[model samples]
Target: MTTISCTYTGDLHCEATHTGSGATLSTDAPLDNEGKGEAFSPTDLLATSLATCMLTIMGITARSRDWSIEGASASVDKLMSSDGPRRIETLRVTLQLPEALDDDQRALLQRVAEQCPVKRSIVPLINAEIHWA
Candidate 1:
């Protein structure tokens, strides 16, 4: 298992350290939530995690198959609920992959991306709309 340690730095801000790699990141509340909005908010990180996880898994699959996805990229837009109970309502993801791939390869990568750990864990809880280009 992996471990991450976090410290609340006051004023709706927090710092997290990845124990494995010593990597660190900071998070702040969004402007709408009474914060400076100078950095990625918690919900933003959630959306980012999904997109990055999908790309990472897809890259792994492509590498295993001797395929190149060197320029593959993904973008995500996070939408929050306006009704009761503040939470994420939707995460719209657009994936752009290299054009050199064939139909079968593209299909395979799409499947791999859909089955990514983050996507499998968060779907239905948060509506995820994925688009490929």
Candidate 2:
């Protein structure tokens, strides 16, 4: 299992370290949430995680099949709920894949992306709408 250690650095800011790779990232609360909004907030990271996870999984599948997804990219838009408790309402994802892939390859990669662990985990909880381009 992977482990990530996070430390709250005061003033609605935090620093997280990836134990495996020594990679580090900082997080700050959004402006609307009474923070400086200088960095990615927790909810932003959640949205980012979904997009990255899908791309990574799709890349793995493509590599196993001797296909290249060299320029594949994804973008996610996070929308928060305005009523009741604070929570993410929707995560709109746009997958931009290379044009070198055929119809069948594209279809397979789309399926792989949809089944990504992050997507599977957050589906019904958060409305994740994925658009392919």
Candidate 3:
């Protein structure tokens, strides 16, 4: 298990440190949620994780097959519910892949991304839309 330490820096900001990696990050309250919108809020990180996880897994798959999927990136758009108990309603992801991917390769990569551990794990919790480009 990993332990994170966070200290409120006042004015709707918090400094978070990752003990394992000696990395530090800052979080700001989302604009819609209140407080001055600045850095990424914690929920933003969650949405980002899902998208990055899919990309990472797909990269690993390509590496294993000796395929170079360079110039590929994933874009994630998160929508939050406006009602009480505010929470993320959907995460729309679009992956831009290199031109090297053919029909079969595209299908395989799509399957891999959708079946990635993080994607499957969050299936019961969030609505994720994955698109290939």
* Model 1: how far residue 116 lies from native, Å: 0.6
User: How high is the CA lDDT of each candidate model?
Assistant: 0.96, 0.96, 0.87
In the range 1-133, model 2's lDDT, one tens digit per residue, is: 9999999999999999999999999999999999999899999999999999999999999999999999999999999999989999999999999999999999999999999999889989999999997
What local lDDT does model 2 show for residue 1?
100
Question: How does each model score on TM-score?
Answer: 0.98, 0.98, 0.89
lDDT of 1 by residue, 1-133 (tens): 9999999999999999999999999999999999999899999999999999999999999999999999999999999999989999999999999999999999999999999999999989999999997
lDDT (Cα, 0-100) at 52 in candidate 1? 98
Model 2 spans > 4 angstroms off: none
> What stretches of model 3 exceed 4 Å from their correct place?
none
Q: Which residue pairs does candidate 2 place in steric collision?
A: none
Per-residue lDDT of model 3, residues 14-80, tens digit only: 9999999989999999987786779999788888888889888889999999888888899999988
